[model samples]
Target: MKKQLLRRIGLLFFLFAFANAKGQSLYEIVFEASDITYKAFLVYFNEQDAYMRIGYTYKGKYNVVDVKYQSVTGQEDGYNYLVMVGSNPRFITNQEKGQSYNPDHFIWVWNDQNPNQLPYVTDDPNFDASHLIQCKSYIEIDPKTMTDSYLRQFFRTDEPEYQALRKMRDASAGAINYNTSDNNSNSGSSSNNNNNNTGSGKSKMHLLLVINTDIGDIGQSCAVDQKAMEVEFREIAKAVGMPFEKYIINGEKFTRDNVERTIKSMQVGNNDVVIFYYSGHGFRWSNQTDKYPQLDMRYSEYTPLTEKTSLPLSAAAKAITDKGGRLNIILSDCCNSDIGRNQMTSTTFMASRSFQGAEIQKLKKLFIDSRGSIMITGSSPGEYSWCNINGGFFTLSFIQALKEEIGYMRTGAPSWEHIAENAVRSTQYKAKNCNGCKPQNPVSAVRVSQR
Candidate 1:
């Protein structure tokens, strides 16, 4: 009887250990401006060690497994580097398993370079290959092991094009000096230029312009509310003490050539905050005809709209930054205007690269080195940007927030971060309530002052 009791106890202990080994907790770590801003509740035990998965939240919805990190590599410096394996596993069907099994979609060992420490490698490169199986986008890790004491790292294979793009972005961002003085003047008038001094060694102004192209037949197709946007822009400018201009593209009065010419002629210089606002029909097309998919920016146009006449984001950003300005803010409120567009066609070119007849090839690099500008957009690639008819949600919220900031409308003012936060929240709320309008995935690409 004693032997049988001991045997039973041992068997129970083994079962418990086995179950623990099979279950792991899921953790979500979000990084913004060098800090970990958000973390999700731990997801407990949904997969095995042989197979790994990662889950994250999108908007307010939980378990948005669209972008999965097959393996995670957590380093000492609070950077939760995500290793993108492929699209979410739930989207892959059994018949597609053969194609999914390709190593191109797998997460391998991370190649971290450390001058003072020894390099770390996985126990077996083939470990992932052996356990290759389809599972939902959830990673199973022991909760106890996830404590702050453990240092983890993840590896991801980077695509050539993606790597190149990231390199370009990083290079561009690195060119600017965020710590540079904002006291330099560009008004070209001695009295007004004297007024441009930054009292506390900080920027005299921070500008944000949100354009909603909802009016013109083409603009309506882009889903921008032009009138609402204009009202919001005018109000924000009035509050911020920045100059404002309107561009009517559909009418012959303001042709694309005229708009481009006006952009070229602007006299922007250091200490002057310049903002370019556009709300109109915009689309992306492939540089090569052979590409499998092509993205089109469709608007209800009485006249046919082509890519050649449209203003590209890259070009607009570069144009503002090139004029020696300490800071340039380009707020584009158009649908599908994010960075990942199909390659540009002959008629269409990247705004960032065009230089608009300027000789600068490395405009991003120049802006980054000089710390000249930042680009914020309404949505990411393949997403629709919306406008609220009642009142331009993004524009209205931005204006109201700025109005609260004292000294802004007046000659002397103190800037605050509340203005940015309020604008983001207002748009988020609007995106959530509007039908056919997904959450506005606003992306800020900048090399600005850390403060």
Candidate 2:
């Protein structure tokens, strides 16, 4: 059945391709209602190449195509048949003698033969000739008149539908300001700061990874937000001087083998900061109950976990402290991420102190004596991390704050304190505006180097 369905779909595609090949001269007309400016363009396929002819529709005429070829231009005589009859029409005529022309052009066509067609063109059976309008235009080329090629529009009107369509097209053509930079410095600093910071090793290297384990068990809004956070963080890291080696794993391209490989390749030194972030489902071992209780770390209903999916936080902390690095910044976006209670119950004190279960400590740190470790988290124990699909509240504000407008508010380059403050502010704002979700709580802690 599946094979038959695939064959049918393939056949339909071939038929549609053939239909498009037959009617290749149809063009698109665009008009702006406000300015009363109009454009008409023909998109067609010849041989295997698709071409377009664009012109303006002025005073009920189109004057667009600029070139013309005589009959004796090519090797073929009248047999050439003027394959294309428009201004600036591109002609491609390479096909086998008996083969039909098939060019790559997308168009929609309707077949009136079958009334109960399962797949009909336009996807509407009620649409008929009355709903469609057709118009014709001419192309003129006169060398004596000094007009190379142009289209003569036959019909120019101010119909309601036409006007409405033109208005929509004009609105769509308008530019949107996706880059919300308040001043000129923000736009210029992205490149300029990168150049200045190229050789400056003043700040310690930090890799923060946040993973939300709540997704593995319960449905949480933070799962999707956590993914977006990782993407933004990676972009920020690239904008700064961090390599791909120093990244917090949050299922971006993470697998068991890749995770192990990343952990094994860690370098610990004075200037290196390694961060691990998790935001999904997390659980704490309950001694009295002798089972793990599902922590409400998400805005949705309470859901419990049977086993712990996240690495023990104590083990992770011990890994950075034992390596004697200048700084280690551990940032987690997960809720109820504390592993203190579970760590004390499950492992011996000596084993817990060592970086046995902790995977982030394997990096080779490369820093001097003047840096300290920083750990930032989305939420603390018994708190929920909120997320909305529209955007990551914490991350969006954090990035904006580091941007020129907010960063320039202070005297120097953005510090971790500034970024954290911005993230918290943004998260709170989003929580208040969001309908169903609770406020997101972000936490930060730093461990300085004694050396």
Candidate 3:
């Protein structure tokens, strides 16, 4: 009976020892960044001579990492490093010598929330990737109740894992430095870019002018002042450093194919800006559930409108966006009423005044660096974009806003948002209050997709 009792006790002890040695949790480590949290497990296995393994789940797959030490140095042996394998190996650090291992000193890869933001990198040696994180993003370790002392006790300061971790950290830092340099070259400095031809620290601006002076019918006709509006647009483009090309479609030349060709030929890049100007008639086609805007390119005689005779505004916008223009401005000075006919009216108003030489100089001095598309319409849907002997109210206000200095010139060029707001307000005030003028309302829309 005594021998049997002793045998039972020995069996229990052996089973417990084996289970503990097979898979022991040494530490559950947490690394935090601004937008992501990486949870790593420091696991000890007796089968491999008590070697430590890092286990983590990435993209929903379990990754078991075998890291070799790269370095561990400090008066109190504070630094500990271990690295996985790859050309751009991910990093895991316990602490750095003579420095507190705070969450703030974390390497930020990229913003997970922002789909457009790419990783920022640099090539500067001694450059730390930790500073890449913005204040809003952060990482946190799990098992919050775990003691810090218990975690620190598992550190092997003299092991190969320490040195390997250091190597991983350096590699990540270099990648960050490289990314930073690349973004700066493309976005912040014109001299570093080959696409910015003039080295004026400004991206090239291209303008395509489309004017329709002869819509044929008297009611659907723009005043003779349409020519004056075109000239004003040319001057505004010159003042704003745009090399513009104008195309007038009055009779048979006005067609969807021609307009599509013009848009396709723009070939805008990340360092290029495009302005599409259309002055004529805007048509709205309705089929119960939908109402779409189209630019009418009517011939001299009254004829039924066909697909070849007009271009859909949506189609034009899609072409511009698809062409990858960094900044796209669409200015349409036309009637947007859905009545299937253009408003015919002659105004005594002449072309509105243009900006002064000094104002133009101020615009030339300003540098705008932004990406996205903004559309400024002459009038809202169901309203007539009034054109007088002076000019179209919408175009006039747009030009005036470009000329006026909202802030200091050196701070940077006026944002599309600022310009659009100013133009919309100015046009509304002038159109509603002007004598013998029909009520007109300007409409503006913006899409900042890839700034």
User: Candidates' lDDT values, in order?
Assistant: 0.35, 0.34, 0.45
- In model 3, where is the ten-residue run with the lowest total lDDT? 180-189
Comparing 2 with 3 on TM-score, the higher-scoring candidate is 3
TM-score of decoy 2: 0.38
lDDT of 2 at 232: 41
lDDT of 2 by residue, 272-314 (tens): 4455544444444444231222322332223232233334444
Which candidate ranks first by TM-score, i.e. highest? 3
Question: CA lDDT of 420 in candidate 3?
Answer: 79
- Rank order (by lDDT, best first): 3, 1, 2
Prediction RMSDs, each to the true structure: 20.6, 22.1, 25.7
Error of 3 at 73 (Å): 82
lDDT of 1 at 432: 49
Q: Worst lDDT window (10 residues) for model 1?
A: 348-357
Minimum summed lDDT over a 10-residue window in model 2 is located at 343-352
Model 2 residue 386 distance off true place after TM-score fit, in angstroms:
0.9
Off by over 4 Å in 2: 1-265, 283-308, 337-370, 391-406, 447-451
